[model samples]
Target: MYPFLRLAKEFYVHRNDPALPLTGTHVSHHLCWPWDLDLWMELNNGRTLTLLDLGRLPLARRVGLIAVMKSQGWGLTMAGVSVRYRRRVRMFDRFHTRSRCIGWDERFIYIEQGMWRGGECCNHALYRAAVTDANGIVTPDRVMRAMGLDVASPPLPGWVSAWIEAEAKRPWPPMAE
Candidate 1:
């Protein structure tokens, strides 16, 4: 089951957090509940992806993206992601997530996030996200302008740029065996 209750709790808990600049980081804490585990008794990779929402949505809310989307009839969607897992998170383990928008290009926004425990990173992810309307994807420039920022996006980091290039070369719909 999706952790709707936990997501609601996250929203309620951070409801009054101060607004953030577009590139500012949002940090939220979490626990590795038993249900979040896999057969190996560590955090499930799939659940880790879902738990990330607990941080990303709040980050969007703090940066005014939620409001912008609401007023403009836009929806947010993930276009792609890359995650790296490095440590075990057993049941009852406590950790925190840090999320931020690294930058954007003509069509997509790039976000970076990480899960940490005991001062070490357990996992990290990079997400390519898009803002869409009924017509189609809304350009990042338009999204920025709607949020009242006319500034140019900071340069995307080299690694993120490389990832984008690599994705472009990947076959769409994948090849059949």
Candidate 2:
């Protein structure tokens, strides 16, 4: 089940919060409920992605991106992601998440986030997200302007640039056929 109620409550709690800078991190705390577990008695891989939404949405809010989306009738979606799960998180365990926008390319924005327990990271992820309009994907520069930021984007991290380069070499449409 989706955490609709939890998201709604979080919306109110962080509603009045001021927007964050492009690189600022939004930290959120969570508990692994019984429903969040898998048959193995640990967090499910699918549910991990779903729960990430709980952190990311608040991040979008803190960055004032949601407001811009609402005003422009835009939508947001993840284009890609690379996540690593290093340890198991069992039910009733408490953890905190840290999410931030790392940088952007011509077509996508990159975000990095992590789940930590007692200062140890159990999982981390890098994501490519796109802002969409009726026409299709919106450029990052356009989005920056909408957010009232006139500054140029920061340089892409070495790892991010490498990933982009790697993606370009990957064969599209699949090789299964």
CA lDDT, every prediction?
Answer: 0.97, 0.90
lDDT value, residue 43 of candidate 1: 98
How displaced is residue 2 in candidate 1, in Å?
1.3
Q: What is the lDDT of residue 72 in candidate 1?
A: 97
Off by over 4 Å in 1: none
Query: Considering only N, C-alpha and C atoms within 3 Å, which residue pairs clash in candidate 2?
Result: none
Best by TM-score: 1
Clashes of each: 0, 0
- After superposing candidate 2 on the true structure, give the runs of residues whose Cα lies further than 4 Å from its correct spot: none
Worst lDDT run of 10 residues, candidate 2, spans: 9-18
Q: For model 2, how does the per-residue alpha-carbon lDDT over 127-167 read when each residue is reduced to its tens digit?
A: 89999999999999999999989877689889988988888
lDDT of 1 by residue, 1-177 (tens): 999999999999999999999999999999999999999999999999999999999999999999999999999999999999999999999999999999999999999999999899999999999999999999999999999999788999999999999999999989888
- TM-score per prediction, in order, is 0.98, 0.95
Give the top-scoring candidate (lDDT): 1
lDDT of 1: 0.97
